[model samples]
Target: MILALYNRQLVEKRSDEAIFNELKERSNYIENDIQSKLLEKNKISLTNIFELTGKDLGISFTIYDNTLQIFNSMDQYYKAGIFAERINPQVYYNLNYLSFREYTIKENIEEYVFNSFYKKISVDNKNYILAVNDAFNKVRLTFSTSDLDVLLFGIYLLAALIIILISTFLADKISSPIRRLTKATMSVAQGDLNVSLDNQEKGELKDLLDGFNLMTNELKRNQSELAELEREAAWKEMAKQVAHEIKNPLTPMKLSIQQLIAAFRDKNKRFDEIFEKVSPTILNQIESLNSIASEFSRFAKMPSYKIEEVDLANVATDVINLFTDEAVDIQLEINDQLPKISADNSQVRRLLINLIRNSIQAGASKIKLLINHENNFCNLVIEDNGKGIAPEITDKIFEQNFTTKTSGMGLGLKLAKRFLDGIGGDIQLIESSKPGATFKVTFPISQKNSFI
Candidate 1:
């Protein structure tokens, strides 16, 4: 509005020369009036024209003719009347000739200058030019950019925090079940065949868990079937042994009775002597048959165990004392500091007695019993310097009715192994080579109730 008013006033004049004369006259009048006021206040200079224009209109102004006057809002004043050629001769010429150009200007303020918008206005007949500027626009733009940067930073920070929280929650949810499955798999590998997993998860993991549970159940069922088949085979083998033992004595008894009948028929004088010999033979064979029957009965009807905490070394010592009259040399090596094991007293004693009887029957001259603690177990090692079991039949040594002895039932070692198994203990043939046989019995330190 101010620029339009000034342009109209300048355009109403007659020519370019008249326009310049009129502007100079107005400038002198304003300067003289300001100087008159300063004189009254004992001042000698004219008041700053830029300060007056900015206070009234919030802008800076400049005028160019043959001379130049530049004023700014900062209360600066510059004049280059005829000496303008000494200041920047090309700059004054461009400002005078470029009457319609409007562009940005850079001028020093304090120690630096910033860009500000300016427009050039032509007076009547292109005799003079006026420049108008607004410098504070750049200050508003700087403040706006700073505020935008702060807002963008806050938004990015919030997004990153939210992503971290979500990632943590998802990781826990996914890994927790996998950890449980890993623990369950370890339990299965360690021989807990009954271990299984829950099928409570969703998607592919749920299918995998269900499949694992089914596999465990199938494994358990297969194991049970195999155990049943082994039991049947053992029973059939025992029956065959019984038949063979009974046939051995029956054949000799039949021969002796037939010879006595023949002698009686002949009516010889030595018939009485032959009858006496035959009578004792028949009696001995009957006793042998009775012994076989008794052994089978005992094997078939194993006694139930009475579980209790007992010192295995003491039990071994008692078994050793029982064989004092025997010709074989028996020695006991025991660690007295060993922890008490949970077992039935009578069963342990019987198990030791059977092993010792086996060594004596095998023609062992020396037997050693070692008792100690190792790896959370109580170990009882029985080593014998006897004719070791043949490699061909080593695996069958503990099978029911399987024996290498001439006048013995094979139930001894089988019954011993069964007894140990019933009490949560295990027996293994550590070595069975010539000149010696070693057997190891291990029992867990802590026992729970178990039965066969």
Candidate 2:
């Protein structure tokens, strides 16, 4: 619309012939100026009228007759006859006669013809058509689709960033509780039945949170009931052990007294011999009962651990040396640098003695005591080539009053474990079903001054 309005204004201001003559005169002046400048510079080169025109008004002017004369930032000339052959047949036919036409063609021609429209011009009684073409590149500033494309891309990128940020925030908001529940589930799996979750939301997540809380509550209740049942069972087992142990001594004591009463009633001469024999037997039974009572009392009133830096290797050596004359072959393997551990020296020695004696009682021929330091812990591994503990009874080996031996009060391993636990150490049966039972005791290495 702007171009048509501009053409109308130009047509109104000057007649077709006058506008044509003016353009021809301007072209002549441009050529003359270029020739003069070239002569002044002592060079033979055509002036780039296109560049000159673009720099000024950004318009290209062309005149066509038997040849085409084109002028723009890049000045070039072409023969109309040759250019016509390369152009579309219809466009060439339209432009072929435009230069010689006597009147204007109002309609704009096709794109191949430089967006040209025909107008009649007379100079010295000869007529020609003045062609005008729009050259946007001649202009310094212009809008293009590529600029719009860049703008749209920036807008889309901003939109995508906003969406991503919003999505991330929503995801965190939605999954935060689930993540907490997942962590709580992990704690539950690790035996933390006391865990509970908060229900702060008002949707499905809230329902999930409530469910999780209920589940944990149920687990806590079940764990409490189970612990109570276990305590009761343990007490019952202890009662049975106590009754059985007391019965062993009581039956013999009662029998001896009955025999003494019977001998007194018989009025027999051998009564004194019987009394002597029965008296010793009664005393031995009483001593056995006393020993059982002492064991129970010691277990009930276990001493608190007096934590001090004690050389573990020294304690192990002392225990091993005590059994030098025993039938078992005991070997102590001490590392070059054994760390002292924080424990009661007497308790450590007692633990070792009990373990060694148990191995000997198990008919072990070879006992290996390995002492070493690893990862800030003093490790004492005792291995015995004894009849390995049966798999069924291995779990009960550290339970108080649980024993396979007939002579013992059955608190050796249990007391050893309790004593170690008191000093922040632990004892474990590494492999009981192997050729030899292996026991591993670990104590945190002491950093204080050592009582080696």
Candidate 3:
């Protein structure tokens, strides 16, 4: 019984596949015929195919200008009726057997020949059409209604059983690998990088699984590298601050030692000469101490912000005015319609001052401060005509106490950057031209509080 059921299901599947294949071939044939007819010099109408060819050949067919409608009719039992109408309402054909004249179709026009009747033709009740394929053309001598009922009932039950079995088999075949893959993915997500899913049965799923595993491994490696990079950046920032803080005190100490050596060499210089030398050195040291104290104080203090809408162009004008009398020429290329930004006025002023000073020190003859807006952020670009910073040290320039100058505390740019950060702004040394460095600062549109 099981074997029979399996066979029934297999047969039903084969029949379905065959039906689809036949319909596809028929559609292709119709398309080719239509194209051929179009190429012919004669006036060829597809409608005539039904009237002339189908009727003459005793084959049921309906021709329509639309391919889909014609194909749909062929799959339905309505093809013959539609064919009759298309050909002519009077033309009709019927299939008859030798012994039993079971069904009769009456026609107004005699367009069909008796055409030796076959007794064992297979009928497809699903489509309400006869399968005229060469493999199933054997004519049945007779059909008994009782026998037919029994045969149909058993065939239907068997086909149902077969389909259930095939479905179960396919489900298991497809789901087993998928279940395995899901488990492996869960393990990976839970931090198990060593999990393996090497199902190499050679199909699309296998390739996808392989690629997924490869991607996971690459991501893991990148994550490790990123962690290392972050650690390095933190250390660099810390070292910068420490060096700058230490150098402040060290500069004055060096000057004091130089004065002591000068006093030792001049015996006749008298108390005034020695006192004068020591006094200037002491004052220098005190100044250095003050600078160091102030810088550290600023670093340690948390700023209070007072954010307000301020025009950037006016701010640039004020900052540039500080260097007006200097030998260097400063230019403001502020956008005429630059938007007012919600930022701390004091912090913006300090940031601009530091940046401008850096530009002047960088040997810029003409510093251009360009203000603009981009992607909802306010952009400030400071360009100089001084010697540009070396490409190698560009990234480290923001570090505390890291400077290329012989004088002054190196905390100017670093403090400016931190101040900007406090106000939810970012600063970057964008590029340097032949003259000097270009620094770009971006401030977010929405500032929660003003900078103090």
Candidate 4:
């Protein structure tokens, strides 16, 4: 558009210097001819010469000698016609000097502008102003831009096409990396530490893509190190707990057996009575030792999940039924139509039992289980009226081997969380307004459950 405007501006505003040059060249060519004719004392008429060169006033005419008897016309009364069409008389004013002027002529009551050049020439030693005139209509007609519209349209079309092609190419290159980054981020958020991106970009984006790959690698490495540290800590803790529990049962069993051996050696009359008493204590201690071993074994190697469509309401009811004879009143409320979730029935039961057992253990007299369906999820809210968890130790509830209880390894909630994660489910402790801990568990309504 700018180029077109510049071209139009340059063409329309042609300078007077350019017009004067054309007029000067035309007049100079005729100046020598006019002088030669005058030296030969021949009568000069421009009509025959102009007729050969052009057809219109082509406005090329010479007013020589200032007699102003200017033209030779084939028509008989040409002088009268010259008077009818007006020409500026200023052509004769600066008769002895070479000069340039613009003048208007009236032909058929319409005004036409003409450019004139006046040259002083020596013809027979008399000063003659040879005047040359150029018509404005002639210049406008010659340099008019007729096909500028088509030219500008083509330029704009080409510009738009180039812009679209370049933009599409750039968008394709940029979007591929963005999509990969988005998917990789989601994987990391879901605890998948194996996500990484292929760096296939250039320039600043290449740096960005490569940086994302590096970040994921660092995250994966950090996660592995963290898991290793946690395993070491867990082993140390488990060893201490096992040693402590085994020592408890072993000390009592050893004392009871020593008493039985001493009684048998002495042949005491009440030795049978001592043996009976010692045998019961020894059996009970053995049972306690077995229970501790079983608990630790369950924690060390959790049962594999068997994914199946399970009715959560039924499972909750069954778990609640087992506690029917207890002092606590376990109330169940269905807020909406419950949806079956894809999960292991046994794990779901265990998870619910652990939460309810914790509530009962905490002295909850009234326990409430409200199950509902919320977009794409089935949520079970277990709220109780017991002594709530202490504020200081609340964060450690779901951590393995962490517990405020005096007995049992605190594997219940941790294993529950691990199971839920396996089936694309989740459990959270809601900050309660009442006096007991509230656990809200969410089960995804639709899941392609896959886990190790």
Give lDDT for model 3. Answer: 0.59
RMSD of each: 21.3, 19.2, 24.6, 18.1
Give the TM-score (vs. native) of candidate 4.
Answer: 0.47
lDDT of 1 by residue, 1-452 (tens): 35444544454332333433433343444334434444464433223543553454443445445454444334333332322212234444555566434333444457764343333433223433343332332222222334544655676678779889999988877886677677656545544454446567899889878888888778767866786798799799999999999999999899999999999899978899998888999999999999999999988767577777787877787667655545679999886588888777666776777787677767799999989898778999999998988899989988988988653446667977887787768999999878889999887675554443
**Which wins on TM-score, candidate 2 or candidate 4?**
4
For each candidate, how many residue pairs have backbone atoms clashing (under 3 Å)? 0, 4, 18, 0
Instruction: For residues 88-125, write the lDDT of model 3, one tens digit per residue.
Output: 21121222223331122222335632211111112111
Quantify all predictions' global Cα lDDT against the true fold.
0.65, 0.66, 0.59, 0.70
TM agreement with the true structure for every prediction: 0.45, 0.46, 0.33, 0.47
Across 313-381, the per-residue lDDT of candidate 2 in tens digits comes to: 877776666565456799999875876788877778777877877887777999999988888788999
Pick out the ten consecutive residues of candidate 1 with the lowest summed lDDT: 79-88
**The 10-residue segment with the lowest total lDDT in model 3:** 115-124
Query: What overall lDDT, based on C-alpha atoms, would model 4 receive against the true structure?
Result: 0.70
Please report how far candidate 2 places residue 302 from its true position, in Å.
9.8
RMSD of 3: 24.6
Q: Model 3 off-target regions past 4 Å?
A: 1-302, 446-452
Candidate 4 local Cα displacement, residue 200, angstroms: 3.0
Instruction: Sort the predicted structures by lDDT, highest score first.
Output: 4, 2, 1, 3
